[model samples]
Target: MTPSEYEHEPIRGLPGDLPPGERILWQGGPEWRTFARSALHTRWVGLYFAAMAVLALLSGSMGGLLAAAASAAAVTGLLSLFAVLVARTTVYTITNRRVVLRVGVALQKCINLPLAVIGSAELRPLTGGHGDIVLVPNAVHRLGYAMLWPHARPLKIGRPQPMLRALPDAVNVAEVLARACGAIAPIAREDAPAIRPAALPAQGVAA
Candidate 1:
C-alpha cells in the first residue's frame, strides 16, 4: 500500500512532542519487520541451533554433543543478541527539514541530509542472493553506500546520503519521504549506480 493510503501514526515507542517549528514527516523502524519471513540469516541461525539441539538429543555421545551445541549456541546467541541491539539502536528520523540516520549502541554515528539539497532519490532493489535497496546520489558524495536488507529503499538527498536498512516497510518509508520532499513520484531504476572500484567504501554490516 502507498503512504497516502496508509494512515499516519506516531511511532509506538517514540515521544509525541516535537520542537517548535519542527514536525516529524516520517519515522520508521528497521525493514526487517516486514521481511522477517524471508530473512536468510535468521533462517540460517535458526537451522543451526535446531540441528545442534537434535544432535544433542539423538547422539550416544550426548555429553560431547551437548558441549558442541553449547558452544555453537553461545556464538549464535551472541550474534542474534547483537542483531537485536543494532536494530533497536538504529533509527531513521525524517522531518520537513532533513533526514537523519543514526546508528549506535552507546556512542552514535549520525548522518544527516537536508531535503532542500537533494537532487533526486533512486530506489534499486538488489537481485539474486539477498534483496536490498541501494540509494545513490545524482552527484558523487560521501554517502554512496548501498544498504542490504530484506526490505529497504535507498534515498538520496544531498551529501552524506543516509540509508535506512532492515526496515519492515521500506516502500512505505520511501513514500513518506517522497511526500515530505514534495516529489511527484518515486524514481524507478533497473540497476544500482556503477561506481569506480577504488571509490567504493566498506559495505554496511547486516543487523
Candidate 2:
C-alpha cells in the first residue's frame, strides 16, 4: 500500500480529480526479477525444475526417486512464489491522458486506459533491462485476457492488449510513454533511455 498509498485513498486508482491539466506522467511497478523472467517463465520454469532436480539425483535407486526430488522442489518453490506475488501486487500508471492498471493478486482493481483509446503501442524488450508495453485499444476497447494477466498480450485474437509488465528501465519506460503518447499517437518507438520521471521509486518493487 504505497504508490504514495494510492495518493489519497479514494483508491479507484486515483484519478478522481486530475482533469485540470492531466498531470501524473508515470508511476511504476514490476521487475520482480523482471516479473520472474518475462512474466513467470520463471527462468524456464526454474530451468526445468533444476533439470528435474538433477534427474531426481540420478534416479537415486528409484522408489519414485524421493518423490521426484520433492516434486521438483515444490514446483520450483511455487513458481518463485508466483513471481514474488506478481511483483508485489502490481501497478503501472502513466497519466497524461490515461493508462492506469492497479491489477490484482486475488481481487484488486483499477484498469483504466484512455489515451484516446490507444490504437497501437508495442515495446517488448526482456533480457535484463526488462520491458513490455503493449496497448492496442481502439475498436471500442473491450479488454479481458483474464483481465490482463501479468499484464497480458501473450495470445492475441480480438482484443486484450493492455500491458505494462516488468518494467525496469523498459526502454526508459517506453520513452516516458512515448513522450506522453506524442500528442495523441506517434509513439512508434523512439528508444528510451533518459526521461527520469523523477527517479521513480514510489516505494516498493525495488529489490
Candidate 3:
C-alpha cells in the first residue's frame, strides 16, 4: 500500500482545525530540485568532487581518478535522495493568523507561529522566482536551530529563524504573507535585494 503519513491532518500541513476566524492565505511545499541545490549544496558538492577528480587525473593515476569520480557520484546521489525525501515530507502553511510548518523525514512535527509573534520576515530570492522566506519570531517565542534543520536559516544557531525554503513563486507567497499579517496589525516594510518583507510589531517576553 502507498504510504500516507499526513492522512490524519484535519487540514493539510496543520496539526488541528483552525479557529473560527482563521483562514489559510497560502499553502505549499518546497520545490525539490531547488531545495536540493540550496539546502543540500548539491552543486557545490558536485564541484568539489569534480575538482578532486581533476586533481587525481593530473597526478597521473587512473585508479585515483576513478576512485574520486566514484566517490563524488555516490555522495551527490545520496544528498539528492535526501533532499527529495525532505521536500516530499515538508509542507508549509500560511494562515491569516499564523505560519505553520509540517516537516521531518523519520519523525514529523508541526510548528505554529502566530502572526502576532512574528517580528520580521526576510526574503532571499533565488533563480526562476524561487526563494526562501526567513521568519524571526519575537522575544516571546524561542525556537531551536537543530529542531528546524533545513527549515532554519543557515548559520543562525545563535538565534534560530524559521525558514520556508525553496518556495516556488516566492515573491507572490511573500506578498500573501505580508497582506495576511498587515490585515491583523501594522507592518513596517523593509527593502530587500528582490522582494520586500513585512516587519510586524515585536512582542515582548515575560520577565
Candidate 4:
C-alpha cells in the first residue's frame, strides 16, 4: 500500500489504555529524514527532478524549465511533508501478544497483529541505527500492503509482510520481537535475517 491511503492525525504515542495482559514491550517511530531518504526515495527523486530541470534549462526553453522547476519542487515538497507527517504520526507498539501499528494521516488506524499469527520475520537495517522488521504471516489474514504502506515490506505477493518501518535501534527491536515470536511461534533464527543497509536490495515493489 501507499502512504496516500493513510489519513493524517495528531500522534499521541500509545493509547492510554491497552487490552488486559497485553503488556507493551517497546514503542518508537520512524526518523523523518531517514524515512525521506529510504521510504520516500527523496535523494533519487530529487536528483531525477533536478536533472530534468537542468535538462530543460539546457534546452533553452524558458517555459519548460519553469514547468520542470515547479514540478520538481511540488513533488519533493509533498513527499517531504508526507515523510514528516508519517514520522510524527506513526507509533509502533510491541506488546506481549501482538504488534500494534498506530498509523494514518487524515484517518488514524490501529492495526493489531497477534504474535501467534506471525509465521516468520526478517530484519533490514538502515543507516544511523535505524532498521525495519518484515513480518511474514504463515496463513492468510485480511490486510494487504496498501494499508501498511511505508511500513509494509516492499515487494512480496500472495502474502505481503507487514513491516515495522524505519525504526530506531532496529536490531534491538527485532531482538525483542524475535524473543516474542519464539515464545509462541515455531520459527528459525535464520529465517529472520538481520540485514544491513548496504546489504538491503535496491529494488522494491513500491514505497
Best by lDDT: 3
Colliding residue pairs in candidate 3: none
Residue 149, model 1: Cα distance from true site in angstroms: 12
For candidate 4, write residues 133-189 as lDDT tens digits.
Answer: 787776688887787787877787556778878888777787777666655544433
**Candidate 3 residue spans exceeding 4 A from truth:** 1-7, 186-207
The RMSD (Cα, Å) of candidate 4 is 6.9
Q: Candidate 4, 116: how far from true, in Å?
A: 1.1
Q: What's the residue-level lDDT of 137 in candidate 1?
A: 47
Against the unseen true structure, what C-alpha lDDT does each candidate score? 0.48, 0.67, 0.79, 0.73
Report the lDDT tens digits of candidate 1 across residue range 8-76. Answer: 324422334445776777765553332332333655766776777777777766776777678767766
Name the regions of candidate 2 deviating beyond 4 angstroms.
1-4, 15-19, 23-45, 48-54, 57-59, 71-77, 97-122, 125-163, 166-176, 179-181, 184-207
Lowest lDDT sum, 10 consecutive residues, model 1, at 198-207
Q: What lDDT score is found at residue 101 in candidate 1?
A: 63
Give the lDDT ranking, best first: 3, 4, 2, 1
Residue-level lDDT of model 3, residues 67-183, one tens digit each, is 988998899899888888888889999987889999988788888888766767887788788989888776555678888998999998988889999999887777777777666
Candidate 3, residue 35: Cα displacement in angstroms equals 0.7
Off by over 4 Å in 4: 1-16, 186-207
Query: How accurate locally is residue 81 in candidate 2, as Cα lDDT from 0 to 100?
Result: 79
Model 2 per-residue lDDT tens digits across residues 88-122: 77768787777888777666667888775665576
What TM-score does model 2 achieve against the real structure? 0.38
lDDT of 4 at 188: 31
Error of 1 at 193 (Å): 15
TM-score, per-candidate, Cα-based:
0.51, 0.38, 0.87, 0.78
